[model samples]
Target: MRPEALALLAAACWAVAALFSAPASQRLGAIAFSRWRMLFASLILWGIALASGGWRSLDASAFGLLALSGVIGIFIGDTALFACMNRLGPRRSGVLFATHALFSAVFAWFFLGERLWGWALVGSGLLVAGVMLAIVWGRRGDEQHGWEQTRGRLAVGVALGLLAALCQSVATLMLKPLMASGIDAVAGSALRMSMALLAHGLLLSTGWRGARPLAPMRLRDAGLIFGSAAVAMALGMTLILQAMKHGQAGLVAVLSSVTPILILPVLWLVYRRRPAAGAWLGAALAVTGTAFILLR
Candidate 1:
């Protein structure tokens, strides 16, 4: 499959993971949940890497780079994202996080000398605009989590979301050159997860302000966290690495930003209600933009 296709698949995986993670995050606290999730995901990825001999290709430099990427992306970016979700709820947080696509494009242009032109550029704009539209205006029944209750923390949440976007963009851009140079995506993912786990663990150990006391893991919470780790951190991240390995980083980021749009159908199925018309229209625009991006 093409890297673009893989990126889209990653988006879908993230959409599913978000559903499982939101409630758990609310219960567990963002910092605690993120730490545990990274630990769980690292263990799973390590098992896969060891079994498949995926670790054979990495030298010291590649390993270090992957580890750094993991710290920035998984630890910093994801922790902030979960915090944003906790404060602003999924809809607002997701829309804010989607700015990672723009950050990735700018970083790729400045650092990697990658550029988009013609249809790809237009598509990227439309895709981002569509997602913003869907998130800003699409609301149906109880699915809406308005910012009214979060008015006090709105500024903080937005700041964290922006931080997450910047961290994620830099992390992905940093990994692109290494991935393109033939790093094993699975091993690289495992390495990054491990590093992120360590970083979070250290922060917890140091009593960082962001770190919260973890509630005892109940069976249901364990299941949710494990499922989220397996799908989002392990599989989704590996797919992202693969996409960056073969595709332009900017294009991959923009395509993967469709996670919010993809979540609409999932929500409809789970809640047994249809999304608002704006959602449908936004989905159409996002799809049309993706088509433009994919077109030569």
Candidate 2:
């Protein structure tokens, strides 16, 4: 498949992952769920890498880079993302994460030296403005009467989300160089996941006190969460790497920004939830902006 196609696929996987993740977090706290998700996903990726001849050909340099990527992107970025989810909920968090696309653009320009087109700049402005309006308007009617309950973690989430985007873009920019230097995609992915697994393990241990979770896990919820992990870790990472390996990371990032748009129809189909008028408008603006960035 083409890199553009793979990027779109990655976006689709993210959309689906978001859908399942919210409920899963509600069942098991976000931190615990994210930890397990990364752990399980790493196992799946390792198995695939071993099967793909990536196990025997690992290089220390590539390993180091991948490990760094995972630490910055998965460990710090993901931890912040979940914290945002817990505090701000999915809608606001998702909007904040649009900043990731902007970050990716900037990082690609710097690291990969990918130049942005005029249309891309225009689209980015629209996306940022639209997302901001959507988030602000969405929060307007919330139960919180003042900014106190609404601001802190939500602000952090937006900041972290932007940082996460930058980390991911840099990771993508680095991937092609590593691959050209003989780093197998599967092996590279495995290395990234392994670092995430290690970090997650330490966090889980630190967070787990003598007491168990406030609520018990259900078997079905466990299955769903694990399944989401597998998809995100194995499938999502694979597609993203595939895209980065062959496509300009900036273009890939812009294309993958379609995740929000992809989620809209899913919400209607899966849960019979229709977005408000402002939401639909925002979503349209986001989609139009993404198209501009991608097509131009």
Candidate 3:
């Protein structure tokens, strides 16, 4: 499969995980949810890496870069994202998260000495426009699902969401050079997950109220969180890392940002109602944008 396709696949995994993650995050809280998710993901990724001898690829340099990426991207970004979700819900939070594509593109141009031109640039524009349209106005006027309701302050949620996007983009930028030198995607992800989990552990051990779980974890919620960790953190992130290894950061980020559009069908399935006109229009634009890059 193409690298861009892998990014899209990662987005799909994330979309699936996000659907279940809202409830889990709501119950577990952002910090606790992220910690548990990373722990489970670390176990799964490390198990695979060890079995396949992928762990051998992590030199000290690679380990250090990945550790930093994990701290910023997974530890900070993931926690902030869920915290935003705890307020704005998945749909709105995803819209804010989609800005990572723009951040990645700019970071690539200024820092990585890379450029996005021609149809790829056009596609990026369309994708971002589509994402904005879809998530901002995709729902029906009369339909307000629980996930559509606000839990807390909207401004705070927006700020956290943007912070998560920036952190994620910066973390991805940090890994580009390392990925170019080649590394096992699974091993890299495992290292990142481990580092982030360690960070979360340290934070929790400080007795920080924000890091503590808001409620006791039920067995079913634990299973849900584990399932989300396996798909979103392990599989999705591994695929994204692989894409980043071989693809342009801007293009890959743009392609993966389609998570907002991809979530529409699932929303319809879960909510038993078609998306509003904005969803269809946004989907069309995003699809066309994706095609521009793929066909270029």
**What's the residue-level lDDT of 283 in candidate 1?**
84
Which lDDT tens digits does candidate 2 get at residues 199-248? 87776677565212445778877787778877666787778887777677
Candidate 3 TM-score, true structure as reference: 0.98
The prediction achieving the highest TM-score against the true structure is 3
What TM-score, over all chains together, does every model reach?
Answer: 0.95, 0.82, 0.98
- Model 3: pairs clashing at backbone N, Cα or C within 3 Å: none
Q: What is the model-wide C-alpha lDDT for candidate 1?
A: 0.88
What residue runs in model 1 are displaced by over 4 Å at the alpha carbon? 141-152
Q: List the residue pairs that clash in candidate 2.
A: none
Q: List the residue pairs that clash in candidate 1.
A: none
Measured with C-alpha atoms, the lDDT of residue 268 in candidate 1 is 71
The RMSD (Cα, Å) of candidate 3 is: 0.8
Per-residue CA lDDT of model 1 for 86-111, tens digit only, reads 88877778889999999988888988
Q: lDDT for every model?
A: 0.88, 0.69, 0.91
lDDT of each residue in 55-88, candidate 3, tens digit only: 9988976777899999999999999999999998
Model 2, 84: alpha-carbon shift in Å?
A: 0.8
